[model samples]
Target: MTTDVIVVGGGHNGLTCAAYLAAAGLKVTVLERRIVVGGAAVTEEFHPGFRNSVASYTVSLLNPKVIRDLELPRHGLKVVERKMANFLPLDGDHFFVGEGRTQAETARFSQKDAERLPAYWDRLDAIADVLRELVIQTPPNLVEGGLKEAIPELIKSAVIGRKLSRLDLTAKRDLLALFSQSAGDWLDGWFESDPIKAAYGFDGVVGNYASPYTPGSAYVLLHHVFGEVNGKKGAWGHAVGGMGAISGAMAACCRERGVQIRTDTAVAEVLTEKGRATGVVTASGETLKARAVVSNLHPQLLFQKLVGPGVQPADFVERIARYRSGSATFRMNVALSDLPRFTVAPEPGDHMTGGIIIAPTMAYMERAYDDARVHGWSKAPIVEMLIPSTLDDSLAPAGRHVASLFCQHVAPELPGGRSWDDCRDEVADLMIATVEKHAPGFAASVLGRQVLSPLDLERTFGLVNGDIMHGRLSLDQLFSARPVLGAGDYRTPVKGLYQCGAGTHPGGGVTGAPGHNAAAEILRDVRRRRI
Candidate 1:
């Protein structure tokens, strides 16, 4: 079979790219290995009567342009913002940050921190605005090259420079520090209260397998805030039908544009001729030909596993090999018999609908990371619980609920030759026990549970070593240097083989910017007959 473009992996980004390509009048086909599409953003039934977003839970960072252009709302996508932002339970106290309540919340601990909250938001908002603009645009090649090859890159550099130039000196300083400093240090400079710092610091380690004090963590913290929910900047919300609803809507949009999606068809190899990607060989031994091939798989998996050896440059191969992957993430979905009653905030309120964090301070977060690095999993693990069923009733049985437990500080690969398969249940119990400490009856309320170890995450969703952001969001692996310096523009060294995954510029989350930016580049190449 033949098509204008063959998109490998029917993840949300691949679906988004296919939609755009088909809209441009190209015949596009998407191949997915799983029985269903959406990749890690899918919702599944983990228990007899409990269904929840399996991998990626919560909603934010989905590009509005993709939603608007694809008309996802018309395809039945609905996202509602959380009434509160975060609920942090202290030893005998609680802190909550919601609309019009952050000041009062901070004042409950420190009056000085309450007054400084506005300045912190103003500074963070300024830096986020700069990154928000950059996320949708392709990163320019910063490495020196031949003059003829350098002209377009230089132009792109100038465009990016102009955007950065908008920032004043103070804003520039703040931006640079975020890219270089630790989240703990950065928050210490702005706030005094432990609960306030811990609430904001949690973003620094969400998909990142690092401590809050780890360098470049401030950037990870910054990465999470650039997203908005329902047009509200930095506000996180729940998709009415779980996270899968977003991808389902995108798939619908793709189908409407004449894109063909084939599930359970895995690509065994990328068929390249004379350094140009021509097509792919399926796992079933059928060869599907195409003018261009787009990969939404992780860069390491695509280049090392699928793309044949000796096809990529030696330097490029080495870079892809050395490209860091993996997260300290251990995910779980619980079928709760009833709501968890917190010790500090027992009464039912809007906080129950938002993120309930178990990490109470920056010190607690650091200890969790340090413990996991050596022991494979944190003894007192950090966990963020979100009860989506509280906001969306369709996910569970009447009066019962489903909650996503995004636990952290587990080693990507265990030490002492221990396998995650052996200890998966034990660690899951530890996570549940940790929550029980904060909410007395949380353990007994769990009617059932589905656990995904770091290894399980890698095997199940193809998130290499469980790195949900595709690759680490470190300074060395971001922007022009992502995946590697030469391959940052979504165009691989092998012509016609492009990357539209989270490993590219803007990096991770449910955001379709990589796919959006990649389609523009691929279309440009098609217009020039480069593909």
Candidate 2:
């Protein structure tokens, strides 16, 4: 059957795009390869009776506009902010941020650093506010075509310039530094304490596989803070029913708008007619037709694997070939018999209801990255543990709990022809042991565990080499140059084909801004009969 548009994946962004398109009175259909909807944002029971958000576990970056537009809350999507934002149990000392006392927490390391905290936040919030405004708008595409194309592209650039012009001279300088400097360098200028810098620098390497000293990493640090939870700026939280609830709500909103969703139906190829996307050919050898086709897959997967050869220009193909992707990420979820008892703060309190970070200082974070560059994984990996079950009891049974371990600095591809499957258990044990060092009983408390190596993430979620941001968030690969330079406004080199995933503008983190912006552009084209 033919439809107005066919979405090639059922990721949260795909569901989001479909919801918006259908709500605009277009007929949309979504096909998902998995049994469920939420691409990587799914929650599942890896150990029987213990369900947790498998991939995109935490919530803070989901766009609030998407929440209100989709009526997520009415559809049973709820998020509870963490009582405390982060807990860093160090060697004989500890650091805590959020849940108030932020100044007090910083003062524990250095009084001067405590005094500088407000100015740091003021500068950060100013730059973050500018990015917040830019996230939902389509970036200009300056390459390809003639003077006709150049005119509109120039107009779009001016519009963005007008927005950036609102920033004061100091804020503009701050923006330039963040976009160009290393997270370590930037933090070194602001705070003199290792603990304070480490606590804040962790954001620089969340999905990034780089060192805190990597240039352009401060922008990654800023990327994580441009989001809010429940109207509180920069506050992280847990979804009531795990991350799946966010996508479940999006799927419901799409269905409510009369969109058809088919699960376990993978599209094998994107069909084109004289260079325009017509529809797709499913893995089952069934052909489906649509006026326009939207891909929510990573740009690499969509262009390299799905679209047939010779359909794209040689220059564009070369540029896409050069598009860097991969991450040093390894994800795990453990079923716990009891909560972790920390050595620094053994007694349970507000700290238990937030993120627990294992890497102590900037030196430790750098060593983890350097070690992973040589060995397949870090001897002392960087780990962030979130006991979402503390706030949402629905994840585990009775008194038991579940924890998501987002470990980093594991090479995306193991060295010397070693396979992750061969050493996954060994690596997982080392990670648990790392946590065990901080929280003595952590290893014994694990009833069972589920691990996703970088390769495993690629095999399971179509995140090429497991780069969760779709591509590295470096300066050359973000905003108008994302995916490619000539195709940043959701439209592709091929007509009637579009991208609405993390690979596009505002890059990654379940923000749904790419989907929201892509839909707006798609609707505009549809209204103009261009697709």
Candidate 3:
């Protein structure tokens, strides 16, 4: 069978790309390996009668352009903002961070830090505004293009430069520091309170395996705040149905535009001839041809595994091999008999609905990373607990709830040659015990629990090393350098082949910018017959 374009991987990004390409009057077909789509952003019933967003639990950074273009809301995609943004429970004292409570919350810890909080936020917001402009853009090539090929890009670069030039000296300095400095050091310079610093520093290490003191981690912090949920900048929310609803809606939009979607069809190989992607061969030995191919798989899986060896330049192959995908994420979903009662809060309130962060101090957060660096997993790990059931009752039965536990700082490759399969339950138990420290009855509340170790993530979701961002968001691997150099614009060295995944520019977190931007580039090339 032949089509205008073949999108391998039917994940959210692939679906988004297909939707846009089909809207442009292309005959697009999406092939997915899994029985259901959505990739990492899926909601499934691990326990009977309880459905939880198994992998990606929260919604933020989903591009508004995607929502507008796909008419996602019309397809039953609704994102409800959490009443509170975050809740940090300390010993006998707690800090609740929300739109109106930051100042007061910080004041409870340190007046000096409290006074600096608003200014700090102002500077961060200024920098975030600058980053917001970059997210939608296809990253410009670092090397100068030929005069004929470069003029349009030069104009776009100038527009971006003009936007950056508009920033004041202070904002520029802050942006540089954020892009270069360690998250711990950056937070330390602005705040004296450990709780205050921890609250802010936690963003730096969400999916990262590195410590808060790791250089380039500040960029990860900035990467997260460049999102909005329901028009609230940097806010996170629960998708109405689950994270799957986002991809499900995108699939509906694609189908509406006459795009063919084939689930349970895995592409065994990307069929390339003479340095050009022709189409893909299914695992079951079926061949499908296309004018162009857009891969939503991680770069390692796409190039090293599917495309196989000796196709690309040896140097490029080595670069892909060196692409860092270190992650420390262990995800869990628990069917709760009842809501957890926090030792500090003791009742169901705004904190229960918001993100409950267990990393109370910067030192504690660092120690969690330190342990993972030394051993395999952190004995006392950083846990970000979200009880989405507090807001959305559709996930569970009457009075029963589901909680998504996103834990971090466990080594992707454990020491002593131990497999994740051997230690998965142990890690899950430790994570539950860590939560039970603050929320006393948390362990008892688990009617059933589903755990996904880092290995499970890599095996199930095709996340190389289980890095949730697909590739690490380190300075050497971000923006134009993402996945590898010379491929940031979603076009690979292999002609007629493009990448549209979390491994691409702007990087990860349910943001469809990669897919949306890749489609724009693919469409541009298609018009010029470049494919």
Q: Please, what are the lDDT tens digits per residue for candidate 1 over residues 161-213?
A: 99899999999999999999999999999988898999999999988888999
The residue-by-residue lDDT of candidate 2 on 7-70, one tens digit each, is 9999999998999999999999999999999999999999989999999988889999999999
Compared with the true structure, model 3 gives a TM-score of 0.98
Which lDDT values do the candidates have, in the order given?
A: 0.93, 0.92, 0.90
* Pairs with steric clashes in candidate 3: none
Mark the regions of model 2 whose C-alpha exceeds 4 Å error after superposition: none
Once fitted onto the true fold, the runs of candidate 3 whose alpha carbons sit more than 4 angstroms away are 142-145
The positional error of residue 253 in candidate 2, measured at the CA in angstroms, is: 0.3
- Backbone atom clashes (below 3 Å) for every candidate: 0, 0, 0
